[model samples]
Target: MTAKKIGVAILFIVGAGVAYAETPSSLITGYTAEAARATPGFAPSAERGQSLFMRKWGVSKTMPSCATCHSDQPTAEGKHVVTSKRIAPLSPAVNPKRFTNLAKVEKWFGRNCKEVVGRECSAAEKADFIQFVSKGSQI
Candidate 1:
């Protein structure tokens, strides 16, 4: 095959791979279900979750606030250009599948907290965080 033709073929393969990536909605839904059951007091605090979402953690080099990427509303979605995925909304009211399990919740919190907060959130932080996010919704 010609060089130009080879390049085009490679591009097509890459594009197809991108198209097959999982949607953020499904990922977040899975994550939420796991969190609700795994983390204790996951259903209590909308206010604290709101604060955590808006607050920037880390003492010296401040990490970006969750709102920086996620917006002020927990149930709202946001885009991550690097990941090529839209962040799923957090509220049960907005997402019918929000809370179902604990494993998925811990998994996402472990991953996302490190990505956004620059550290793995503590158990207390996770609880407060879940409470903060699950707040105001009928869970």
Candidate 2:
């Protein structure tokens, strides 16, 4: 293939990868809408987000909360309490790629919330959690 064609192909692939990952604000907006639909006058609160992050729900003794994997300090890297896998910092200030992909975000939240909270997180909970993660990452 011509060098020009190869370059274009590479660019297309890269762009496609980024296409679904919108800004953190956009993701929060979407979650907010979903939350509002479920319950009118709902709003995302960072304080609620922090509470969800820190509270030990006792769902998993090993992975008690988001703090188990994400740590109370979002800027700090955490290792999985279960698998011992090194987890990346969730803070956007430290990791530019945080909260970029809609699908990846939902996928992990679905898995992690079930594992930690013992059920799928509601949209309100998701918004609060995301608002926390997004704000924490910034700082």
Every model's TM-score: 0.55, 0.81
Q: Put down candidate 1 lDDT per residue, 68-113, tens digits, no spaces.
A: 6565776777666456578777765576556444445556776778
Q: After superposition on all CA atoms, what RMSD does each candidate show versus the true structure?
A: 13.1, 9.3
Looking at candidate 1, what is the lDDT of residue 125? 57
Compose the digit string of candidate 2's lDDT tens values, residues 2-55: 343243234324545544446667667767776786689899998888888888
Superpose all Cα atoms of candidate 2 onto the true structure and report the RMSD in Å to 1 decimal: 9.3
Give the least accurate 10-residue stretch of model 2, judged by summed lDDT.
4-13
Q: Global lDDT of each model? A: 0.54, 0.75
| Highest-scoring model, TM-score | 2
Global fold similarity of model 2 (TM-score) = 0.81
